[model samples]
Every structure is written in structure tokens, then in C-alpha cells.
Target: MSTTETNSGTAPAQSASALASKNPATGDVISVHAIQSPEEVRAAVERARSAARSWNALGFDGRKQHLLRWVSYLLDHADELSELIHAENGKPVDDAYLELVLAVEHIAWAAKHAKKVLSPKKVAPGLLMANFSAVIEQHPLGVIGVIGPWNYPVYTPMGSIAYALAAGNSVVFKPSEYTTAVGNYLADSFRLANPELREHILTTVNGYGETGAALVTSGVNKIAFTGSTPTGKRIMAAAAESLTPVLLECGGKDAAIVAADADVKAAADAIAFGAMANSGQTCVGVERVYVDKRVSDEFITEIKKIIRDLKPGDAEGASYGPMTMPSQIDIVRSHIEDALEHGGRAVVGGADSVKERYIEPVVIVDADETCSAVVEETFGPTLTIRTVDSADEAIELANASRFGLASTVFSKNHGMEIARRLRAGATSVNSVLGFAAIPALPFGGVGESGIGRIHGEWGLKEFTRPHAIANQRFAIPGMALLSFKRTKMTTSLVKQTMKLLHGRYK
Candidate 1:
């Protein structure tokens, strides 16, 4: 652990307690970040709150300009940011670069669409209130606190950060301790793009769980957290103490279903990338595959061929990078071992694939539905394949999990139909993890997969509170709806009108 100070003059002095961000590839420290004290966290939130008054006053146009400038800054230094992400999170340079590209796109989407999505809109006053005109608009929620994850550090946090800012709210971001440098880099860049509003806009707080807890109760209007389900629950509880609302993008056991008429080779290739990319550390990564028994053998053979030469290492040309979190290796090993112990067979790499920082890509077949490998979120380079008699059976098994973040269905004839039946926040038909790249689509999960959404119009609204206004455009003759001077005849007439409009309610 070490400490560093904020470049902004308004930032509080660096604290003695600090945390180290390390390279999972070689177990070397990449950077050290100062852990903000609870008091410091409170101070940052107050600053953001003060800034929000003027920021919200900037309206959509002003905020959009600044956000786009931030986007420009990110693109100009994309290579440097990607390298920082690679060194800190242990993902390959190419993967890190891809994450940044997607993040930049999201920033642009949020900036371009925020005004349209959140602007005030006129609505009908309905028959009962025909004399009144109604309008609804979204108002910024002051400061937003974001707790980000290490896997896809840049992209995941930016999902909330960009949307929050675009919605006209200041943000206080807490990046994962494992990738604190990347988080700081983003905040620093944002300041450089908008130096006048540097202290009032985006700020980064770096540390482990305690620091995150401080942010949770730091009086921010809302908290957006991305991490494990258990951690999400903890954040929810902490925010409860202050009655603060939270948006959780938690864990997932996402599955891919291969229909009888599916393209086996294409499904295999897609599933391989979905499960092995980022070393399968993705919250929406394909952890389970339920294939039609008719195509199970062919599907397995295709996937085996696809990943046969794939390996996980920190070397050039490797299929993927090492596991970002060291302790995750044990979880990966246990899941593989449990699957084997419970009558599963490894069609590709097995428990022996687990190493210090890298677990070779593994594809297990016939894993029991109740086994940890198939049931729990094994955030590693592993996939469990189960054979099902029909698409209905696959849907049943896929929905059996308590988590429902995302799922994919591959079928030429029934792709869309099967996707409709799956219980997930977003489903990809004929493709894998495709919904994530579409900014207009809302992304979030139901049940233990987490709450609320990010991206698109829904994301913009998530960071805003709706305000409705009604104005009387005219007065109805002989009507005294709220007047003490209302007569018995008026009341009788109102009752008759209500019954005429809703007598069917009986």
C-alpha cells in the first residue's frame, strides 16, 4: 500500500493509508493509490453537491459539450489508457484497447442522446383533467457514487460514469483496488478536458472495501456498483442505512443455448470467445451452455477444435491473458474439481489447467445442473456444457439459476423465439454478447444478477428523477373540484360521471 495526492488544488491532502494496484501477469506492483478517509469521502461528495447546482444549471447543451470534450480526450490518449488497463488488470493489450473503444462509444452515445431522452415532454391530461396541461421532465440527482470492478475496468465503470455525467450529475468514482491507476487516469483526463469544472465534476477515490463502504454512505444521491453478488448485497445494506438508492450490476452465470438447427461451428466460435475472452472474467461471460441433444456432440466437437490450440498466458499471441484476480484461480479450480467429482467430463482442459495467475481455457461436458461449475458464477476461463432434449429444456435449466444477467441463443429458424423465452436482462440471438455493444439497448439484470440498468435512454433516466408539472389551461363552468363552495349537485354530478366512466370496475 502507498499514497498519492490529487493534482487538483481543491482535493484533500493524501492520506497515509494506501493500496497497491498490481499486474496479475507477474505479481508486480504497477501503482499505489491513496485511500480516501471517510471524512475525505464526505468532503468530496459535498464538493460534488455544490458543483451540481451549476452543473445542472448548465442544462443538456452545456453538459453535452463538456462530456464530448471528455470523449475527445479519451480518444486522443486511447493507447496510453489501454496500456495502463493492460498492466493493471492483466488483460491483453488488444482486449484492453477494445474495452476503451467501447467505452468511448458509450460516452458519445450518452452525450448525443441525453438531451432527447431526458428532455421535458408534453402529455395528455386525460378526460378528467381535460382543462389541465401536463409535462414531465427528468432532473439530475446531484452527485453519483460509482463503485467499479476490475474486469473490464474502463468499460464497466464508464457505463455509469458517462451516463451519470451526461444526465447532468457530478460523479465520484471508486475503481477496484486492482485497477486504481486506470480509474485515476480517467478522472485526471476528465479534469484536463474541463479544467474550470475539474473540482466540481468527476473525482476518483481509490482503495479496497472500506473505502468503498465510505463512498456508499457518503450522502451521494445514488450509488452504482459493479462487482460480485455478495458485494452488491453489502453495498445495498450500507446504502440502506442512509436510504440511498443503488444500482447494482452484479454477478452472472450467463448461458448460451444451441438449438437443434443452430450453426454448430459459428456457435462454437462465439461461445469460445464469450467464455475465454478477458479470461472469462466477464460478468456476462458464457459460463454454461445448454445444447440440443441432437447437436450436442457436434457442438462439443466444434468447440473442442476451436479452443484446442488456445492457451492463457501473458505472452504474445496467447489466446487470452492471466486471471485478473489471484484468488479467482482457486474458485476456478474448485469448480472444475467439483464438476469432475459430480460425474462431469472435461472435453478440453480440466482442473490441472489451473495455475498461479492463469487458468487455461476449459470446456467441461455433462456437468450436473446442480454442480457449482454449472450453478455458480465461475469468473474464470471455463465453460460447462449440458445436453438437453429440446429448447424448452435448455430454457428451463438456464432460468434455474438465481442469477439472470444475460444469455445467448443460436438458431437459424428459432433464434428470436428462443431468445424471447430465456430469462435474462438481455439476450443475443445468433450472436454472443452482442447486446452489450448496442448503446441504445438497456443493460442490467433481474433477481441476483443485480438491479436497474445502464446505457440508452433507460441509463440516462436512471441518473435522473422525474418531475411532473400540471398547469390549468382553462376552467370548467360550474365545476368546483377543490373548492369548499362545491354544492351537493356538483358532487352528485361527479359521482355520476365517474360511474359512467368506470362502472365496469364493479
Candidate 2:
């Protein structure tokens, strides 16, 4: 690993005109893309704005036809796309395929349900205004600017891309520099699937931070970003200048609770996979655990057995693959050293587990709450376990982190109760990441984890706004409350009605 050369997916600008995409495992250049300047970004947004008009004119049924065709295209090209994901993103080919499967599920959900979810519906006009019929209509925001991450390039960005498109809006996406070619392929496939449609319905802007900054202020109606918490904050602050709405999915130090009643073997297996899968680059991956003292030793022993056998490589039978970003290697290394320096001990693998690009799964026990490994978002294959006296203690420890993204509970009898007690946007009971596979559930985090929800009904609604319409049926001349010519008798009647309906409750 070279300290002087590090790329965080969203790396600094190397050339004024081009960005190269490279394979993380072999350091081989996959492809090169042209950097879109600020002027080019604006032009792209304008094109998208024009495309949005035609897109919305197609209506829900027409759009669904196109989206479903896109789904077919994705399925047809699954092998080719998965291979690209494996080489550029440094994840196992099977893991890449699973990511694609989840992404396809979201795309299908957003397409099949958009019309029903976004249709105008009658809203009740209460007794105070019974003469008017009211309805709320969903209106699509013109153009959306999406800034995506490299970890799960297809799945993560498609959360925004699929939902936004279904809601009748055009999009301009700025994919991470590390996976530029993969991003381009997604947009290109959309056009290929629907050749009769306009090209500007979806587009890509290639470059580093400057390209992203330009998109935020490119006269787009909304901006959706997925990355670190610090980057989320900066994007929010910049978007505030134009009052551009943002949907951010940021960093998470997610935790899991293992109760004494949990199935020991099942809990251990799930934890082992949850913590180390995708090289632990998942934003919602399990990084910490709190187990009851009675079951702590057993859980640790079972998990260690699983970790010792798993290996990371680009070979045919590797458990996982190399770290996608070069710079993240340093962060993972420092966290392990910090954990050991602060009196925490590794029961499985220690600092030596961290190699140049691949990191062996390390499990730390007795780590203090203040240790960097426990406190920060370590994008590596590592775990920190602490013993607790009861479920109350476990819940308290799990909720102590600044992030409230996702959590899991392993309990035979009290899993649901414990999950409800934990502070998180989503909770899985006796399982890991159950909510992610179900496209009907919305996914997002609270606090430092970022704002807004994606997937399911809420995900479709995020790209549109409501418009309320009130149509008058008939006017009672004497009881016209909104008119200046209302008589004293009507005012007296209105006062009496108000007291009868509301004032009596007190």
C-alpha cells in the first residue's frame, strides 16, 4: 500500500479533462471518462429539464412500460454487469450479483407501485367546510442531481435513480470516480432499452468533487447523495444556498444485540457474515455488538470459527475481495492499532491481520466505548463485542452511538421487544439485514446517518411534492365564512358550532 497515492473513490482531480477507472484488486485501468466541467454540467441539467417535460407527458402507464423494459435489460445483462462490479468495486462476484438482485427488486417496486402511490386522492373536507371537495396530487420535481458512492455502486445509486425515474422526473447522476465506467453503463443501458425515448432522461457527469459541487448548484430541483457523514454535511450546507432539497444516506456505526435467549449458532453465523461481507464497506453493516454475559463467550467462540476460515482475494473461491478504496486501508489499520493501544484485546485476528489491500476479519473484546474502533465508521472487516448484564444494558449500549441508522436483535422470545427499544431507523429481529431485501420497507437513518427515506412508498414520494386542490360544490350565501359580506348571525352560528365540536373537549 502506497501512502502517497490514495483514492477515496471520490478522489482529488488528477487531470482537468479525464478520470480513469481502475480495478482495485489488480491496479489495472478498466476505462477512462471525460470530466464534465461546470458549464457542461449546467448544459446537461438543461437537457434533463427538457427531457423531464416529455417524460412526464408519458404519464404513469407509459413510464412503467419503459421502467419494466429497463428491468428486463438489467436481468439480460446481469452477467456482464456483475463482472464489471467485481473488477472495479473489489467485491466477490456472487456478492455483486446479490447486490444487482436487490437493485432490480427496488426498480420493480418503484415501477409497479408508482401510479398507485402518486395518484391524486380525495382528502376529507371536515364539517367546517363540507361544501368543498378536496384532493391531493403528487407532482414530480423536474430534474434530480444524484451523487453516488463506490462501495455498492449499482445498488446504492439505483435507490435514487430507480425511484426518481418512476416519479416522472429526469436525472443527472455523478458517480464516484473509482467506478465511473459502471455508472456510465447503467445510463447507457437505459437508453439502449428504450431507443425511442429521449437520451436526456438519464445522464452521467464524470469527475471528482468539483463535478459533484457543480451538480448541486446546477438548477436541479433536488439532490440525492450517498457517502460519509462529513460529506453529507458539506453537501447539505452547499445545497442550502439554493434551497435545493437533499436526500442523503451517510455513515453508520451500526450495532447488534444478542440476548441470552438467542439461538447461539444462528446468531453467530449471521454476525460473522454481516460484519465482514463486502469487506465491511456497507454503510449499514454491523460494526459493534452487545451480548449478555451468559452467552457472550459462546457467541465469540462460534463467530471466531467462521472468521478464521474466510479469506479475501480475487480468486475463484475467495470469501470476499480486496478493499475497494485505497485510502480506507489506512483508516482500518489505525482503528485496529487504536483499539489495542486503548487496552482492548483481539480474540481472533489482530493488527497483523491488516495486509496491503485485504484485511482479515478481526474481533476485539473489552474495547472501551471511547476507542476509535467502537466510535468511528471503520470500513473494514472488524468487530467489537462487549458483555452486558441484561437486554436493558444491551439496548442502552447499542443506542449510545451518534449514528441511528440500522440495528439487529437476536433473541428467541424477546427479539421484537428489544428491537423496538433500540434507537434506529430499521431493526431486524433474530436476523441480519432483513429489512433491506424487502422492497416494501423504507431505508434511511436518523441523526448523523443523514436525512430522507429511500425504497418502498416513501422512496417514490421523495422525488415528488403534493398539490392540494379544493373545488367548491355549492355556496351558502349567508354562511360564507371566507366572504367579507358575512352577516352577524352567521358569525354567531359559527362560534356556537366551534364550541360544540372542540371547546367541549377541555
Candidate 3:
């Protein structure tokens, strides 16, 4: 690893062209970044492409070693990385550190398991191809273009990046317009660990929508994009021009069900954290809550108490920071207003909580299904509470949304039963967003929640293509359709064999 730094310790001045990263809590400038041009992005992709060939040729053991070294580096410098994440994304230090920890685990998981999961496995060729032996292997798809979002920036993107690298594909990462500095820090750290593979291994382009579009159209072999559903659709369309495959991780209107048998306090606390942490910028954050009518009043009161205790600021002592994106303030305001206008009550915080860059936790109750706050992906520190007669009703309401990323069931019994009917990719019983922490479980959703899985063995295969190869072991004359010669006797024998093999009746 070289101490050689490219454009470190120096940043573009705070000008019109600079993307200024602000502290979500205090609204102070944490760093300034220059949005790279399209040509510069092209160069970065080309460098990654060159690096990928050599990096990919290193075989599984060599790649695993490099990944382990990278993990070691992250552990050695965990504090520094945590601070950078906090400064860039405006979450509390604990949240940042936790994300870094999860990322480290993801990196290690991808490294240690990629070989076993992606390597070829023998399969029976079957009676049709009885003379052949077949094997299926997952092959690297070459360069992958990754577009990340701001919330859990490290954890979310690494789900794609680490897995892609493990699958032997180089990545050209373009982080959110709001969190470019975090992207830069990660890419730079990788270079520090694997200097020889620096060019082919990783490269970052920091910018906004234009930069992301450039990456999507940059002729990469595949695109792994995580953001809003609309953006995911756009990325898919752009990649369609090149017929490039994509793994889209998009938005969610996730719900948390509080059954009659659930603990009110525990459910409330889970709701508070799942909705307000990261200022609710998380894709799988719980935006809607369906509480049993039997416990609706008690649950709402407890949840309000939890929201009241959550303080949002840029100070060191705060639990959460501001909305990282300056424009999100308006979005948050609009959603709160829409809820209020629709007869919803903000029991704790309301439109008044929407500050310049920060938003206090808002818990809205009596929200109708048609309200935007209840239906839309309100990526803010706000939640909508609804009541239903039974757990079945809760599942029905949760599955009604087009987005089905992750859902939670809080019940002493029937938790798993209700979870199964939710139509989401993942469900956490008696917990919120707990599936994401388990490295072995697949993480992703069906429908609008996005396409493709991002964690576990599924993640490792998302960046690779399954290649099936068959070898002929022996030849049987007149045993199959390979020859058009006289085969009346052979045909009778084949039909009898087929019937015996399949155990079919007359």
C-alpha cells in the first residue's frame, strides 16, 4: 500500500461548483468536494476495468486475502472512518460506528463465502443427456457500476460493492449527491490496503444525478443501484440501451404490526428507532405502523413518549442529526402538512419541528390510508399509526402498498404466521429491521421494494452470471435422438426406460 495520496488534504473551495457537505445537526461545513466531470468518470471506469482483469485473475484465495487485508485496515482505523461517516451523513457517532461495523462484517462475509458459494457444482445431466456430466458456476460479470444513497451510505453500498468484488467484478461507485465524501474515504481506504490493484479494484466519482447517469450509461457490464424506486426505474431504462443487467435496491413503505399480544413499550421503542434513526432516511425504515385496535390507544401513547425523548441536533450529545440533504426539509414539511390537513394528529412533533436542516421526531396518528404520509415513502423522522381489528387486517394493510421491502411483526404468538403473509422480502418478529444485521439471510424485496438481493449468498451471486457446462462421458448408439437410423426396437426400449425411471402408470 502506498502513502501516495491523490487529491487528499486538499479540496475545492466552497464555491458554486463545490458540493458542500454539512453537519446535519449544526448545519456546518464538514467538507467540500468537486463534482467530477463526465470525462473524469469515464477515466475512472476505464482504470477500474484495467484493474479488474488482473484482480479477477488472482483466484479466490488471492482475492480473499486482499479483502481480509482491507477488513484489517478498516478495523485498525475504525474510529477515523466512523467520524467521517458521522460528519458526512449527520447520524450520531454510534450509528456511524454501527454502520461501519456492519460493513466490515459484510466485507468479511463476502470474502470468506464467495468461493464456496460461487464455485461450480456437479449436477446430473438427466435421461435426455444421460451420457453427459454437467456443472454450474457463477462467473464474474466484469465491471459493475454502483449508485448509492445517503442513508447508511457505507452499509448500503458495501452490500453491493463488497459482494461485487468478491464475485471478481470491479466497481465504479458513485455515492449520493449528499454523501460524496464518505464514498471518497472508502475508495481511498481500499487503495491503501491493495495498492497494486488500486486502479483495477476501485474508483469513485462524486457528484449528483448527472454523475450517476454517466455511470449508468458508461458501458459497465452491470449496474447495482440503490435509491428511490423512480430512480431505479430510470437506471434500468438507461442500462436497457446497452442491455446491461442490473440489481436495483429501491425504496420502501415498510410497516410494523403491533398485535394484541405484543409488548407496548417494546413495540414503541422499536418504532421510534426504526422511524427516526438516520433521520428516517433508511430505505427499509418503518414508515407505517398497524396497531391492533385492542391496544391502539396504549401503543400511541407509548410511541409518543418515545418520540418526545428523541432530540435532533448537530450537537455531540444528540441522538440524531439533521436531515443530511438540505432539500429534504421541504419534503418533510410537506408530508407533515399533508397528514395534518388530512385530519392526522402529530402527537409529539409537527410542522413546527421542521427546521432549516433538522427535523424533530414526529409521530402522526389517525392517519388515513390515502394520506401521503401514510402511503408515500416519507424518508423523514415521522411515522403514521393506523389501527386494525386483527393481525390478518394488519397483514392486508401492509401488503396493500406497492413497496414491500421489509416488515415487522410484534406478537408473542403468530408472529411468524403474520410475517409470512406480509408479501415482503424480509420480516423481523419482535424486532425491527433485524434481518439486515444477519449476514447469512438474504436482504432485498419483491415488487417496488426493488429487484435482486444484496446480502448473504444471494448477494455474492448478484454480480455474477451462472454458467452451465456439460461434458459427454459416453455415447450410446440409438439411445437418443442423435441419430435418424432405424430404431423401432430402440424406441420401445426408450419408452419403457422413461416410464420406469419416472414411475408413470400405464
Candidate 4:
């Protein structure tokens, strides 16, 4: 995500190894981070491997204490951290705090629920193995390498990091190069919170793409990345050499569907906020809307009215701040231009609304489904509204994209029905982004949007490996099917049982 903006402040990285963190709104240099070399990344991984022993030994309750302490520290320093996030990520301070709140809540959930979700569980032994007792135990997967995004820097990466750590694994975090300072602050805060814990329980490695590549191949137990689909493919390929597993939360061209029966005003407000919040950098941010033709007129008018007056700036009461990644400004401009060139009309702000640093909310109506602005992930404060004859047509158009991430539906009568029919990992009914705020729901995508879930009982299990134990409680005389001394009678009995259990279907 930090990669969204060039280290050279909207340009490419320089020959110097140090990374300069700048304000996207003002181009002010906040700080410079020393890029870690491949060797350094390996060393960090080794340290995590060593620290994993102690981390695992802590058990659920022991680890929970430290994680909660870290949460307390974050809360105590919320203002400070939010300010840093505002400066580097260009989000409003309140929005930054909201991101932190969600992240902290997820960490707390992972900590308190890890034991319940991951503890050993008894299982019934089959009739053929009646003498054996079966139990499934979940164990920490040693070390986790997390590649975070800058869009929702705190909330996104913490989804993986907190769950991984609470599940009993040590972590090596590579924050987006843009949010390097915030990442280091997090790792440092953990150490400060639990003074007794040694280094490597949680660590950070700073750099651009090279550092992340080094981490993928540095023999971590698994790599959890949140970024573009192409980068995810490359990481998967590189991790294949050693066969390390990966959990990728890639791009999303999320959509919102407004049915005819929906409350037009409510739908408009939620979708408008979802589309432009935090400058629309959210992976699950709404980029397109499919409305029923019967209500499309009112829905369009309402959304346009809501966002027409919205302006972008770093000043107080601003709708949203400037684009955090300078490179993204051009993409937003291009999407607006492409849409306009392809029979789309901008009802609110047009191509000129995209400034050097800030992008005002732009609403382009009647964009062709095949256009880039409609199909691709613009990652900006823009939305495309399309009118469909019916909810079925709306669903068809909404699911047309290769991405199947998060989507929203606003229909008092058919909200649940439309949500269930969506081709997304999570669908919010009646409100936009409802799934993201709930800690119990696991979040991820089916196709290019991403692979694997990360926010619930499933999230806690993502960083663990299951170990099944089968112990013999007693042995049946003359029924030693698994022993070398098994008789012909035992074999015949198994065949008869199989036939009785499975051959009657015909």
C-alpha cells in the first residue's frame, strides 16, 4: 500500500537505499526508513522462528494477556498513532482512529477466542475403529510473514497479524513502504507493553519489493499478503520453491445493488460513504452500483446530490483527504476520462475534478459494463451507476467482473435474497460494508479479489496447522485389522461392513 505512492513522492524510488515517507496532501517528508536487505529479512525470520517457541509456550491465556496489553497501549496512544496515519496515509484523523478501533477489536477477538476456536476437540471414532480415541489439535505455524496494505493500513494487516499471533505464531511484518513508521510503532508498542517478552515475538522489516520477496522465501511458515492480484501471483510462485503457503487479500471491484423497494435515501447515503470514504482506497470500497430501473432515477439523483458538494482536502470538515498514493491520482483521472469517452456522463465531478493530490468524489452514470472504469479497480473516490431492468439483471451485471470480493444490497423485501445470490465473499444487506465491521464474519474473496478468509473462527485457524491424534483405548480380540497379524476373517468382516454401508444405494 505504501507502494501506492513512489518513495520519491509520486515518482519512482531513488538510487539511495533509504525510503522517504512523505505526506500525499502536501508532499512533506515525514521520515526516512532504511530499506532492509535480503539478508536482514532472513535474520528477522530466524529470530521469529526462535521466538515462536516462547510464544507457543505462553498458551492461549498467557498470549492473550500480552495481546490485550498491546491493545491497551494502542488505545492509550490512539491520538498519536492516528496523527501519524493522517500525515502519511492522508486519511482524516477520525477515520484513522476508526481504522485503529476496528483493528484493536479484531485483535481482542482473536485473543479471547483463540482458545475456544483452536483448542483440541474430541471426535467420534468410526465403527471400524471403535477402540481408538480421536482428537484434533491445532498448533501454531511457527512464523507468519505479513505483507500489509496502506489503504486501511492498521485494520487490514492487523486482521492477519493479530489473528496469527493469538493463534500462537510469531510474526514478521512488512508494512507498506508508505506506512513504515506506523508499522514500526506497532511492533515497538508490543515490546513496550510486554517488557518481559524478548524480541522476535513480533518484528518488522522495512523496504520495498525486495524486502517482501526476501520474506516470502525466508522460510516463514506462511505468508499473508494484502495487495494487488498480480503481486499475489508472483508471491505464490516465489513461495512455491520452498512450498510455503500463502493467504492473499487482493484487489476488489466491489458493487452495490439498489432494488426498487429499497429506501432510496438510505441506500444513497450508505453507498455514497462506502464509495468515497478514506479517499476510496478501500479494497472493498464500492466502485460500481447497479440499480433497478424502476428506482434508478431517484437513486441516481440522491447519490449525486449527496456527493456533489463533497470536496477533498486535509483541512477540518473536509469530505476526505488527498489521494495517499500519488500514482493513484492518474488512475482515477484516467477512469473518469475512459468512462466519459465510452458514453458515460459524469453527473457530479468530471475528469477535471481529479487534482494534483486530491480527487473530489466523481459519479459517472450509465457507464458501459465493458469499460475499464466499470470493470477495473480504480481505487479512488469514484462510482459508476448502471440502471438494470430488474434485480436479476442487476445481479447479473454486478457479478460480471472477474472480482468477487464484497458487495452490498439495499432491498427491504429482497435484501437477503439478493445478498445470497451475489458472487462475493461477503455481502452486506440494507447497509454498505456491514460485514467488515463485524468481527465474527470471515472476510476474503473467491476469484481475483483474493484467497482465504481473515476475521473470525476461520481467521484464528488460518495461521495454524491441525494435528489429529488417534490413540487406541483398547484392542478387540481377533479383530486387529490394523495389525500385521490380521486374519482372513477380519478382512472378510471389513468387506461385509463396507458392502452393507455403501452398496445399498443402487
Instruction: Compare the candidates by TM-score and give the number of the best one.
Output: 2
Q: Which whole-number lDDT from 0 to 100 does residue 285 have in model 4?
A: 84
Instruction: Write model 1 residue lDDT over 217-255, tens digit each, in one string.
Output: 889999998987777887888788889999998889999
Where model 4 places Cα greater than 4 Å from the true spot, the runs are: 1-12
Question: What does candidate 3's lDDT look like per residue over 22-131, in tens digits?
Answer: 66656677777887777888888888888889889998899999999999998899899889888878888888999998999999999999999998999989887889
Q: Among all windows of ten consecutive residues in candidate 3, which has the lowest summed lDDT?
A: 1-10
lDDT of 4 at 141: 95
Q: What is the lDDT of residue 319 in candidate 3?
A: 74
Q: Write one digit per residue (lDDT tens) for candidate 4, span 206-230.
A: 8887788888989999999998887
Task: Tell me the number of clashing residue pairs for each predicted model.
Answer: 0, 0, 5, 2
| lDDT on C-alpha atoms for all candidate structures | 0.87, 0.90, 0.84, 0.89
lDDT for position 478 in model 2: 88
Candidate 3 pairs with clashing backbones: 24-322, 25-313, 25-314, 26-314, 51-200
Candidate 2 is scored at a TM of 0.98
What would you estimate as the lDDT of candidate 2?
0.90
Models ranked on TM-score: 2, 4, 1, 3
